[model samples]
Target: MSRRVLVTGGASGLGAALVTAFVARGDRVLVTDVREDASVPDGASYLRLDVTSEADWEAARAHVEEQWGGLDVLVNNAGIASGGRIDVATLEEWRRVIDINLLGVVRGCRTFTPVMKRQRSGHLVNTASLAGLVHPPGMASYNAVKAGVVALSETLQFELAPYGITTSVVCPSFFRTNLGASLSGSDTVLQSIARRLIDRSGTTAEQIAAEVVRGVDAGRPVILTDRPGRRAVLAKRFARPVYEREQHGFARRIKEAAEGAADRSTTKDGA
Candidate 1:
C-alpha cells in the first residue's frame, strides 16, 4: 500500500532527503515549501506552503483531500536556523523564530488533525533538533522553539493516540546541510559556532532522513537522529553531574571563542 505523505520544507536539506526516501519507497509524497522553487522528487507532488500562514495550511489540507483523499503521514519540517544568547537576540528576533519554528508546526497540526481524526490513523513527524533535548549555551530561540516542538509532539502523542494517530519528534544532532544559510542571530559567537558545526558535521541529511523513517515506522515517540545525541540524552537522564559538567565546558568554549574573535577584530582594526 502506497502511503500518502506530505512533507513541508521539502526543497532542500533534510526535507529533500526525506522526500527522496519516501519516493524511493513507493509512497505518494506531496512536497510543500514556502519557496517558489520547492523541489518535488520524481513521482511526488508539490504545493506551495508557508507554515506561518493559515490560508496556506488550509490550501494544503484541501490539496490533500482532493488528491489523496486522506493523509497517512504529515512531516512538519519547515523551520529556519537561529542561534543567539538570550539578551543578545532581540525580542523581535525571538518572536520571529517562535512564529515560524513553533507556531508554524502548531498551524500544520491544526490543519491536519481533523483529516487524521476522521481517517482514524495517521502519523505526524515534527522536526525538532538535539538542542530541543539538550540546551547548549547560545541558541536560545532555536532551543526554545525546538523544545516547544518536543513538548507539543509529546502532547499530541497522547492526545491523538485515541484517534489512532502517532507523533514523532525528530531531534537530530548537527548534520551537513544548508540550514546555515537561514541562520540568523545577533550573537556572532554562537552564530559562528552553529555555522561551523553544520558545515563540519560528519552526519549527512540522508542519514538523518533514513533514521527518521525507521523511527517513524517503528512508532517511536522521541526520535534522536544521531548516536551522539542519544548519548547526550542518556547522560542527561542518568548522569546529572556529568551532564552539568559537559554543559559548562561547552559554554566555556563559546565564551573563549567569542573572546578570540573580538581579539582578532581589534587587531585588524588597529592595523
Candidate 2:
C-alpha cells in the first residue's frame, strides 16, 4: 500500500526533492512550507505552513486528519543556517535559530505524536547536519540545534516504539541547495566558508533525498547522506585524537581569517 507522507520545508531544496521522490514512488505526498503553494512539486499536494507557528502545525494536523486519515511518515526537515564565533554571534541570533531550527522540530514532533499514537503507526525523519555529530569552530548555533535534533530523534526512537513509531535522523554534509540563502551570521569568514562549501559540493539535493528515502524505507535509525558526512562521523567516533587535531586546525583557520579581515579593514581605513 502507498504511504501518506508529509514533508516540512517541501517547497524547495532537499525537501522538494524528497516530495518528488515519494510522489515518484506512487505515495500520497503532501508538501508544506512557508513558501507559496505554487512552489510545491508537480505531483504532490501543497499546504501553506510555517513550522514556527503552533497554529500552523495544528492546522496541518487537522488537514491530515480530514484528508489522509492518518500519516505514515512525517519529515521534520524545516530549518535555517547560521554560523559565527562565540563573541561575534549575538544572543538574539542564538534565540532566533533555536526558535526555528530546534524548537520547530520539537513542535512538529509534538503536534503529530497524538495522530500517530491514535493510529498506532508512524515514522519521524529529522534533518540534522554533520556538524551535529562533529562540531567545528564557528557555527555554534547551528551545531547546537542540529545536535539537539540528533538527541531528540534518538530519544524518540525508544520513547515512541511502544506506539509503533520509528525515528530517523539525517546528517548530510554540504550539498548544492538554497539552504545558504537562509544563512545569517556576523563572522564574514565563517559565513563565506559555508557558502563556498555549499557552492562547491559535488553532492546534490536529489542525491541526499534518495539516500534518505532508502534509509527510511529500510527503517535505519540514523542516516548519513554523503561520503564526507559518513567519514566525519567515523573519525569523530573511532579516531578521537585525529578528530580533535582536525578541529584544532579548523579553529586556527577561523582565527587567521578573522585577523585577515581585521587587517583589510585597517588598510582600507588608512587609505
Candidate 3:
C-alpha cells in the first residue's frame, strides 16, 4: 500500500535521503523545510515549515490531511547543532538550539499525534544523535537536546503503542551532512576539529536513510545506525564504567587537539 509520509527538514541531509527512499517506494511524501530554496525530491511535494512553530506544524498537518486524507508516517528530522563548553555557551545559544532541536520534535509530536490517533495507525521516526546516548564534551546544548529527544521518543513509544502508533528514535553517529552550516559555538578549534572528523569519516545520508526504512519496517523502538553506535548503547547499558572511561579518553584527545590547534593559530598570529 502506498503511504502518505511527511518529513521535516526534508531539503537536505538525512531528511533528503529519506525523501528519496520513500518516493522510490511509491509513498507520497511531503517534504518540509524552513529554507524556501530547499531542493525537493523528484516525487515528493515541498512545503515551507519551521519546525519550532506550532502554527507551521498545523499548516503541515493540514496540507497532508487535505492532500492525502491522512498521514501514515511522520519523520521529525529537523535540528541544529551547538558546540562549546557548557560554561562558555551563552544563554541565547542554548535556547536557540533547544528550541529547534528539542522543542521542534515536541511540537511535531503534539501536532501530529492527534491526527494519527484519529486514524489509529501511524509511525513516527524521530532523528536523534548518538550524542543523545553518550555524553561528549564541548557539546552541551546538542547533547542535552538530543538526549531529551531520545527520552521523549522512548516515552512516546509506550504511549503511542496503545493507539496502534509506533515510535522510533534514530540515533546515528556522525553523518556527512550540511548540519555544520548551522553549527554555533565559541569553541572554534573544537568545532573545526569536529567538522573535519565528520567530513572525513561520516557515513552518507542515503545509507542512514535506508537503515531508517528498515528499522521502521521492523518496528524498532530505538534504532542505532552503525555498529559503533549499537556498541556504544550496549556499553552504556551493560558496561557503564568501561564506556565512561572510553568516552573520557576520546574527549580528552579531542580537547588536546583543539587546544593545540588554537595554540598554533595564536603563534602564527603573533609571528
Candidate 4:
C-alpha cells in the first residue's frame, strides 16, 4: 500500500534523503522546509514551512488535505542543534533549541493527531537522536530536547495505539550532515565536539531513512539505528553502575582534552 506522507525539514540532509526514498517507493510525499527551492525531486510535492509557526503548519495541513484527503505517514524530522555547558549556555539559546527541537514536534502532533485519529490508521515517526538515550559530554539543551522527544513519542505510541495509529521513535547515532555546521553558530565548543563525534560515528542518512521506512512498514514503536546505541541502552538497563562509571570517565577525558588545548595556548603565549 502506498502512503501519503508529510516530512518536515525535507529540503536537506536526512530529511531530503528520506523524501527521495519515499518517492522512490511510490509514496506521495510532501516536502516542507523554511527554504523553498526547485531542487526537490520529481514526483514529490514541495511546500514552504516554518515548523516554529502555527500558521505555517495550518497552511501545510490544508495543502496536504486538499491534495491527499489525509496523511498516512507523518515524519517529524525537523530539528536544530544546541551545544555548550548548561551553566554557560544562554537563556535565549535554550529557548531557541527547545522551541524548534522539542516544541516543534509537539506542535506537529497537536496539529496532525486529530487528522490521524479521524482516519484511524496512520503512522508517526519522530526523529530523536542517540543523545536522547545517553547524554554525551556537553550537549545539555540538545539532550534535554531530544529526551523529551523520545518520551513524547513513547507516550504517543501508547495513546495512539488504541486508535490503530502507530508511532515510531528513531534514534540515530551520527552521520555526516550540516547539523554540525549549524551548531557552530550557536556554540563553537559544541560544534567542535560535534565534528569529532560525526567523524567517529557510523551510519548514513540513507541507511537511517531505509530503517525508518522499514520500521513503519513493520509497525514498530521504537527504532534504534545502530548496534552501539542498542548496546548502550541495554547496558544502562542491566548494568547501570558500570554504564555510569564508564560515562563519567568518558566525560572526564573530553574535559581534560579541552583543558589540555587551553594549556597549549598558554604555553604559546608565554613563548
Which of the predicted structures, 2 or 4, would earn the higher lDDT when compared with the native?
Answer: 2
1-271: candidate 1 lDDT, tens digit per residue: 6899999999899999999998888889999988776547679978899989999999999989998899999999999998787778889899988998999999999999999999999999999999899998877788899999999999999999999999999999999999988776688788888888889989999999999988988999999999989999999999989999998998899889988999999999999
Best by TM-score: 2
- TM-score ranking, best first: 2, 1, 3, 4
* TM-score to native of every candidate shown: 0.97, 0.97, 0.94, 0.94
The count of residue-pair clashes in candidate 1 stands at: 0
- The C-alpha stretches of model 2 lying farther than 4 A from their native spots are none
lDDT digits (tens) for residues 1-271 of candidate 2: 6899999988888988999888888789989999766565556788988999999999999999899898999999988889889898989989988998889999999999999999899999999988788899888888999999999999999999999999999999999999887776677788888888899999999999999999999999999999999888899899999999998998998889889999999999999
Give per-residue CA lDDT, model 4, range 1-271, as digits (tens): 6899999999888899899889989998999988966478888988988899999999988998889999999999999867777665788988998999898999898888999999988888999988899886678888999999999999999999998899999898788776665674544555677787776667678887888888778888888877878888888889999899988987786687678777988999999
Q: Looking at model 2, which ten-residue stretch has the lowest summed lDDT?
A: 35-44
Model 3 Cα displacement at 81 (Å)? 1.7
lDDT of 3 by residue, 34-75 (tens): 987666767788999998888888888888888888889999
For each candidate in the order shown, give its overall lDDT on alpha carbons.
Answer: 0.91, 0.91, 0.87, 0.85
Which ten contiguous residues of candidate 3 have the minimum total lDDT?
Answer: 181-190
Stretches of candidate 4 exceeding 4 Å from the true structure: 185-187, 264-271
Which model scores highest in lDDT? 1
**Model 3, global lDDT:** 0.87
